[model samples]
Target: MTTIPSIIEELDQLRPVSDVAGKVLSLLDDSGCGMSDLADIIRHEPALTANLLKLANSAYFGLPGKIGDAKQAIVYLGMTQVVDLILLVSCADTFKGSHSGYGLDRGALWESAICAAILANALSEKKGFKSTGLTFTGALLRDIGKVVIDQHVKSAMPQIMERVETQHISFMAAERQVLGVDHAQVGAMVAKRWHFPPLLQCIIRYYHTPLQADGCFTEASIVHLADAICRKMKISPGVDDSSYEEDERIAHSLGLNETVINGVIGEFSEKMEHVRTLFLAG
Candidate 1:
């Protein structure tokens, strides 16, 4: 009996991202917003400020000396990267726990999400997409519906898996067949409730099937490809790992081929160690 209303009701009890994080996301569309505005807001959240400074000083960025404050971090990392880190730090706790519904243990989902976000950012840059940050955020939060639907999915795992085995459809399709809604759709609902931008909402909703997004096909496709690449790498995979499908047409449209895909994978593998240690460390 996990109806949409029930799931929507569960959102009220779910831990919310910080107000400061929400404000940063809201400012993304503002032409007047600047680095100082973001730095000021982040400075108020000591935990977020600490995490940002730690990440800035990590070997991943390779700055000359220590970054002492949020403003300096912003100056070094740039606004998009700073905002990406804010959202990542703000949402990390929500994704830290085990989600058995998707066969993800403690920290597994977070690792997978971080991998997807990085790959999506890389792909966006390769494709020369203007919304690299949007793609990064979209890939990171694409599976957020699982947070709300985990228990339901766990209870119905048997039936969902049966459909997956017999029908040879994606896990998302089986989710819809058994539960009347899939994670992507539910994720879109979460984004809407959180007042995320329309483009982001669309990317989360249609990432698995990017062609369905009217105006956001490219952004959604990038996330979709990134998720597929993550699963292919077996990086913290879930029960739905091999059950997901990729659209060759979408890849072709994005000018992605086996060579480009392999290059991204190699690049991701090289950076994986540093990123995991830096982002997941206490």
Candidate 2:
């Protein structure tokens, strides 16, 4: 078996976000970027421009008449939401594919990821967590490590699963024991290679083990619950299945009791169903 350091060092296949999305991310991280500035940057990507225009006119936005202008679309959607879509579209090639090793078919990871992102955004807001956009992005890109380590994971599944059953450990823990690294840790390395913010790196690194996250424990916890909810609900089973246990204490810490959990499930479903069409059209 390869050491974790070697596995990380060998991760040269990590996909870089598109230049336009990279620029947009830089500006979003900046404190001074305005709507006009964001519009100016997105206009250079013709496909992104067209998609934004389409989404701006989608029924979900409910604007009067048509919005043919780039600035208008940016204004209507807000920078955070626009950035969210950009990240999705830019990384589509990377995340929208099937990873047989991880048990996700084509676009399964994409569906689960966006679903988790939407819920994480909502959860962060409800919990009064700072930087909801960061939370959303972290959730969206949390499992990217799976892409790098999927084949290794798949080959080791027999041992991984055996540990899960015999040691009373989560599937991810078994992954660590078998591979010396889990998807979450590999995901953090992926994020670092992609120039993701430190907080996002931390969230991805410890999403499956939020208690290990020192810098962004709450954010990691939010991502954890979101992933668990998706897996439990089978929103997009991927390869991980639904073997991991949900941390009720973590949910309680975020004020997600049974009622809130039920509400989150319902809201997550409704939101995905309602806005997915817009995303597809875009």
Candidate 3:
């Protein structure tokens, strides 16, 4: 079996996160990372600052007036939003292309990622999770392995789909059986290479199999359910949407019944549409 370090080394050579985004992700677990701290770090990057301002000022924020500077934008946007933007800016270059590995067309992965992220954020709120920042970030980048392992997956898709069709297994499982590594595992290595927080790493690594996560089970489960919901809604980008089996037990484990789950999905769809509009408009 290929070691994790080897995968990380290969992925690092493929161009990792920007320095600015690395700094932002490092603060994912910090409790006292204030607005000024984030502002100080983000303001140095002109392109990041501009993009962050535009997003904050977009219909997403519904602010009364324009955000004048990075600090002001941080104030209005909150630390989590700023961090999410920074993460997006960091990975946008790599994730911008068509990730044919997962059968996603141009921009499809980003669309599904954002929608799952929005839904994860909503699920966190319903579960009364105070620090939903990492949850959202983890959800947003859940499929990053797809970008890293696109070609490998593309090459094996024929055999992979055959396995999926022949046996009652998930695309992820098929990927593991055929390719020896699934996107979740690759994504976890990618997250580790970037020094993502432990929970975030766990979520990225186990979003597809929340039951297998050793820790951060709730957040991982949230991402899993959110991803499944987005897949059902056709927002997810992949040829194996059927692989995301709907497990009511996942919701039950989170203390959420069917009604609550549906409500969260409904609200997530409405809010995600707005986020989609703003992001695509940019």
Candidate 4:
């Protein structure tokens, strides 16, 4: 039998989405790249450019006029949004499959991930966090490790589920017991391999337990809340597949009341189709 550790070690060498995504990150590193510069980069990839233009004119943005070009998109959507949209579009390929191990069918895991990213972005705005760029991208990519780990897990599903049922353990804990490493660690490893931003790596690693994190750039609370919200909406298949509980600290820290949380949830539910169009069209 191939041990999980060995499989992971071998898989670690695979760049997956890193090669292309790394270049995208590099181009946006300074964040000073203007519309023309960004347009030049988008034009380098014909398909990406086409998708960008299509999404810009989609109902999600609701511009009065059609956005026929990358430059027009930047003008209508702003540079930060344009850059974030590029990253979102480019990263979608990394997660366009099913993970039977986690019981996520085609696009199930991806849908949940997108919801998490959307909620994370909404929460960041509510909390007045500048630059939801990193937060949105980080939340979206948080489960990249699962893409790699799910196959091995699918093969060991029975044992993992039995342990979860018998011991009442978290899915991640069950995963660690059965596979010798959970998705969080595997995700961090994947993030490092992909040369993702350090803060993003941390966000991926500690998303399940934000309060335990200690360092700069803590969006742990945001990710935690977003994950809960997505699960409640059945966007992804959580291990237990139950409704998510509120992290009281997270809400308190953000000064969120029940009304506000409910309101955001309502908004998300209403706009989900629009958001879905943005991602799918890209």
Per-residue CA lDDT of candidate 3, range 3-45, in tens?
A: 4454456787777778888788777667767778888897788
Q: Model 4: per-residue lDDT, tens digit, 1-282?
A: 437667667566654663445666665555665568777777778778887887788888789887888888888888767766777777776677777777777777778878888788888887788663467777888888888777778888888889887887777888889888888888888878777777777888888877776652358778878888887776767554542345688677767677877788999999888877677543
Arranged by lDDT with the best first, the candidates are: 1, 3, 2, 4
- For every model shown, the clashing-pair count is 0, 1, 0, 1
Stretches of candidate 2 above 4 Å error?
1-6, 128-132, 280-282
Instruction: Report the number of the highest-lDDT candidate.
Output: 1
Q: Model 1 off-target regions past 4 Å?
A: 130-133
Give me the displacement of residue 217 in model 1, in angstroms: 0.9
**Worst 10-residue stretch by lDDT in candidate 2?**
273-282
lDDT of 1 by residue, 117-181 (tens): 98999898888775434899999999999998999999999999999999889899999988889
Q: What is the per-residue lDDT of model 2 for residues 178-259, given as tens digits with 9 covering 90 to 100?
A: 9998888888887788777777899999888787789888888999888888887787685466567777788887777777
**For model 4, how many clashes?**
1
Return the lDDT, model 4, position 118.
79
* Candidate 1 lDDT score relative to the true structure: 0.89
User: What CA RMSD would you report for each candidate?
Assistant: 1.3, 2.2, 2.3, 2.5
Q: Model 4 — TM-score against the truth?
A: 0.89
Per-candidate local distance difference test: 0.89, 0.79, 0.80, 0.75
